[model samples]
Target: MKNEIIIFSGIEPGKKGAGNLVYFFLDRLKINYVEFKLHFNKTPDGFLIRQLKNFVPRNLSKSLYYSFYRFFFKSSENIINRKVILFHPQSIGLELSINLIRNNFVYIYVFDNFLFCRKSYNYIDRNKSCLLCLKDKDAYLKYKCDFFPVKHNPHKYDDFLLTISNNLSRVHFLTQNRNQSNLLYQKFGPIPNLTQIGMMVDMEDVVFNGKKTVKKYDFLYHNTLIEAKGIFYFLSIAKLLRNYSFIVPFSLKEVRNLIPDFEDFENVDFLSIKWNTGLKEILINCQVVINPSLWSAPVEGALLKSIKFNGCVAVVTTEYSFQSEIPSNVVIKLPDNLVEASKILNDVIDSEKIRINYKNEAKKWFDLYSKDIDISFDKFIQEEFN
Candidate 1:
């Protein structure tokens, strides 16, 4: 008999990355499930009710609006039989929803600690030095990180926790920074039945043709052009490497305008490529890929993609601990300072051996990781639910 699983995430169905992975895994397993796009508003007529509440008398209108909202917005009691429900990014509101649908089916929560920390929002606003969420009562709430421990209270919501890394499981996997695994272990007691599953990528359509030197540009930087992503820092490095060709993909024109004394260096070109088309083609052509994220570790998929294309990675050591063994060709643990990062990247370009080694290493690693994902999914279902 096929087991039915319902996986729910806070994000919309097809934005990118984790959400995309979730969809891919479910499809691969051929699991019978429904993907529901969660609505954040507490009421259907919330917008109209709030507008009317502002003009009408406070006491009577507020009571009437809330009563109407609750009657219409409250979740129904229909529960799926012999099914397992998995919730990503623990939230008090989500836990409450699960309780309303509770039956004999198992409920599991996937933990990604970075989602709970303030540093997660480092890329959001460059001008703002720190993340501060005035809405939440917790001191660490400022970053707009969504995880809430209150949702995990046993008496209220008893659900199994599946962490992303073994090191994280030891510390209850509170942050995305793998380096802080020990720190978390010190804070929280040891976790039980924890598993380490690296980030998943859909490779069915990914065409790999050994390594080819297609020098469309000397260097490329993909991802949002925001502060924490180190876009400004990358621009400065491009200025220093005056002779080398640099490509900045999908950066807003306004971001370039913000930099003072930023000249249009002849070799540097800013290309407005949509992520779906231009970005992929650029990755395929570039000789090197540079990622200088100030916050959050390197996503496994991003790092793996760079390696697959036989490109070197220049990223902050603090963010991505370089925990998993990497191809020596793929450079990790670069200086947090942009000048140092630029120097290292330049030196690697000069070293032919380094480039060759990385290409070979990346292919080997991808093969090892690319083993049938369906097998893992089947194992997870049997072990966890059965």
Candidate 2:
């Protein structure tokens, strides 16, 4: 029987990391597949929906908006013998689409433990996981925890998630690592089926380049500078280290919107993420990359990329267990305490010994992880039959 694999998601081109990883691997798999992108902004009535977003009641607005999408853009019924791989269908009226994935052939991949969180950051009580949403349905609203899926309709979001979680138990899953697995188990009492698949990280092209030698920025933390992402922590470190420079990849416009206070800081520069080669060049020259998130990261692409570049990675204790999957010495585990993490980072600045050792250990770690990455897809496919 010919199999049809559909990778469904809600993506904004290059924005979501999970979407990017899923698309890359599905293409590499070279199978009979369909890429059904769920773009909310471009939907037929999207403009009208936005025009009326504020006027309409929150839950009613979400229901009308997503119900329109569910009615218009539907799951293709062509594949009788096929499998579905869902990244994040939360945006596509998940409340209405639950039945679309009710079959026995579906496989769901949970990239983020957002299910555990009152918010997508997977934290409620600053820098820590809060399970209040599990008990109090109003906890999401109480904390003002805005999320990508069901942002306007969180009550419905809770209902859909409970249903999705129940459905998720019916299929085989692709778990990232031991650390994430434990976290998911903690959040979700117990699961019936799981296959631990390592993240698909390829960085040989960006890692090794003899031509790129100019280190324009002293440090780089190129991600959406949100509070949950420890943006304030990075800024706090920059405030102390006045001598060194730091780059946060955000547009001049974004800087004004996201961190207006930090715009004047001489040590920090927020550059717009460009579509051109400039982005890669800027990434190559950074002395170190840091992911100072206080919350647990299931699939840490940033830290992995830093290791791939043979550069240094500074992180907090939340990443300790995830770091073990790499077995690399390049990772400089920072303390969760804001003051202490900065102090350790201060010592790391301009330390030639630290840089050299990190690059060396990264090479050893890359050799091991790359080999496993090569076969992860085959393992994922095999899980279906076995």
Candidate 3:
């Protein structure tokens, strides 16, 4: 029998903001496969039960979610001896993916830091980027890096690493960037089965018309409204550059909740809308799109989309481990210091020649990335066929 591939992820492909590499490859390859997604909840919980969960400690509630996922997850024995490709699975789903390693040829696509860090974002204390957990297993709890305010288990990292190490022989890991793959090896030792596949961008989703229009906003911060994603840094920059017009996909109240000390800036326009075609238009129309994430983000979607579709220059935080492969001229990288970063952004905004140069380099960089993705896909397909 042909080795049918089982594609498993947290959700179904082709959903909103779900046009990821796996989705792209599946459509292009047309490989014989069946799909599986973790059901959030097969049956609705009682209102009181849901309320009780809210009252429960965040760590315990997180445990509950995993238990619920496992309870609803019905894995078929037919998957034995088959090929399974896990694409950006949730923590619980990742655990399940590890378990499948013994019985099947498992290919795990790493998008987040779930394997090393329990919090998975690889960020700490709101403003700092971290990767200490990769080498020192105690770093997660020692640094109090839980996503929620609740205390985390001390041995969570230890146990998670043990599980992954045990299943290493039967698994193949695919990282989105070469730098990400290198970081894994530098921290976790040499991993022979790891492959670096550049992130896939669907051209159909890109909103680039031939005509160039006037920029309505001076700066755009369309990332999630979270501190680790550098919303605070963006705020700081906004505070510094009060004269420059800024736009975000969040309300003033929502922004205030994250940065309680946030001021009501008249120059900042908040558009609370779903990230659809409308948001794409806004992104392309903006003079600059900032992705100041305080983490070793491996080719962020926001930054990639902005570079691929937007007419303006993309600005990002300098993450040596993540952005090492990205061309220096393609995107403007700012230092960790808010003041220094603000100065760089100011320079970019003021100089039309610099913006044009960055945009030109960005086109070359994106073309290289696209070619890498195509080559990676071809190699992956050849391996799968074999």
Candidate that scores best on lDDT? 3
Could you tell which candidate, 1 or 2, scores higher by TM-score?
Answer: 2
lDDT of 3: 0.66
Candidate 1 error regions (>4 Å): 1-3, 31-75, 78-115, 119-187, 206-215, 254-265, 319-329, 372-377
Model 2 residue runs over 4 Å out of place are 12-16, 31-71, 76-82, 125-138, 149-152, 201-215, 319-328
**Between candidates 1 and 3, the lDDT winner:** 3
Residue pairs in candidate 3 whose N, alpha carbon or C atoms collide under 3 angstroms: none
lDDT, candidate 2, 232-310, per-residue tens: 7777778877889998777555555555665467888876663233555776677777776666666666666666663
Candidate whose TM-score is highest: 3
Pick by TM-score: 2 or 3, better one: 3
* Every candidate's CA RMSD: 9.5, 5.4, 4.8
In angstroms, what RMSD does candidate 3 have relative to the true structure? 4.8
Error of 3 at 50 (Å): 14
How many clashes in each candidate?
A: 3, 0, 0
Q: Rank the candidates by lDDT, best first.
A: 3, 2, 1
User: Cα lDDT of model 2 overall?
Assistant: 0.61
Each model's C-alpha lDDT?
A: 0.49, 0.61, 0.66
